[model samples]
Target: MMRLRFLRPPGARPEKEFLARCLQCGQCAQVCIFDCIKMRTGFNPFTSGTPEISPRDAPCHLCMRCSAICPSDALEDVSIEESKMGYAKLDRKLCHTWKGFIICRSCYERCPLKATAMVLEKGIYPAITDRCVGCGVCEHVCPEQAIVTIPTRFVT
Candidate 1:
């Protein structure tokens, strides 16, 4: 099977486990404060109603409320610091700041984990760090489309 890449809500298990464990109850979507979580669409029986976050539409705030109310533990109640929904990768060649065409700070300014997940190199150009949780805010805010948030969905 061709592995599909998509960001799950924080606390989601590996792909196989998440599909098996998720009840598709929509509880996680109900409790999301940032309204980032949305039920998966399409007719795939293996993935219907599973909560996902598309940072371009809305970015997760790292609030663990969705996990806390999960009756089936499909979304584990994990610490915000440990959340790894996805990671942001910068294409510096396409970046306005890096290219010196513009001093755009869109990604840096919008990063939820600013200074930790996204930082300025040499106090100017933005760089992604280890602390990045791949929340996709940078991807949403990048004016030059220089950022692509890489989802961390693990497949078996």
Candidate 2:
């Protein structure tokens, strides 16, 4: 079966290690101030109840509170720069600014790591940089739906 593409909380360990270490305790979900973290719902015993973030529905703010409260150490306590959530892929063809339809900074302006993660190319088009931690704010805020956040777990 194809697994759903979803991001783990910030500072999450690798997929395998994260699953093994996750206690399904729901603490991470409970502490999320943005309410972006949701426990996977289903009968799959192994993955059910695990915290997952659906960026388009609600992007993580990278507050790091969930990691701080996790008793199992599944999500490490790391700085915003070290979160490694994933990376945002921008489809310029669909971006208003990139296409020269209008000047839009929705993604660039909303990015938590503004100048580092997302940049304005030629003072117009939005560009994703390697420093992006893929918190998904870009994806969530893009009016043109031009940004997609590829979770780190699915990178390989």
Candidate 3:
């Protein structure tokens, strides 16, 4: 079955491997300061209670508290720079700046990584860079809904 483009907590391992390793404990959700992490609900035995993030509801703050409390190695205690949660992709067709109409800097302004992850190409259109950890802040903050955060598991 095809899984949705679900964003996992930062430092999560590969999707398949993570589902196998994660104990479905709510530890990560309990430790999150921003309350961005939520235990998966419903009756999915493979991943029920596993921590996930829905940027649309609330974006991750890169606090790393969840990883510190995770008992399973599914979430690694890694630096925010290496968290590799996901990557932001810009949809030029929907981007106001890319359309050459608005001077919107919403995505760039909200990106936690700032200049390193999201930057204005030619001092105008916002472009997603390799440094992006895909925290989904850009996706969450984009006024035009032009930015999408792709989970690391799908990046490869």
**Which candidate achieves the best TM-score against the true structure?**
2
Candidate 1, residue 103: the lDDT equals 92
lDDT of each: 0.84, 0.91, 0.85
Model 1 lDDT per residue over 32-143, tens place? 9888898888788888788888877787877889989999997788887677887889999999999997899988987878998888999998999989988888888888
Stronger candidate by TM-score (1 vs 3) = 3
Models sorted by TM-score, best on top: 2, 3, 1
Candidate 3 lDDT over 24-57, as tens digits, reads 8788899898888888887877777888898877
lDDT of 2 by residue, 14-89 (tens): 8888999999999999999999999988899899999999998999999999999999999999999989999999
Model 2: ten consecutive residues of lowest lDDT: 1-10
TM-score for model 1? 0.91
In model 1, state the lDDT of residue 95: 98
Cα-based lDDT at residue 102, candidate 1? 84
Q: What TM-score would candidate 2 get against the native?
A: 0.96
Any runs in candidate 3 off by more than 4 Å, and if so which?
A: 1-3, 154-156
List clashing residue pairs in candidate 1.
86-134, 87-134
TM-score of each: 0.91, 0.96, 0.92
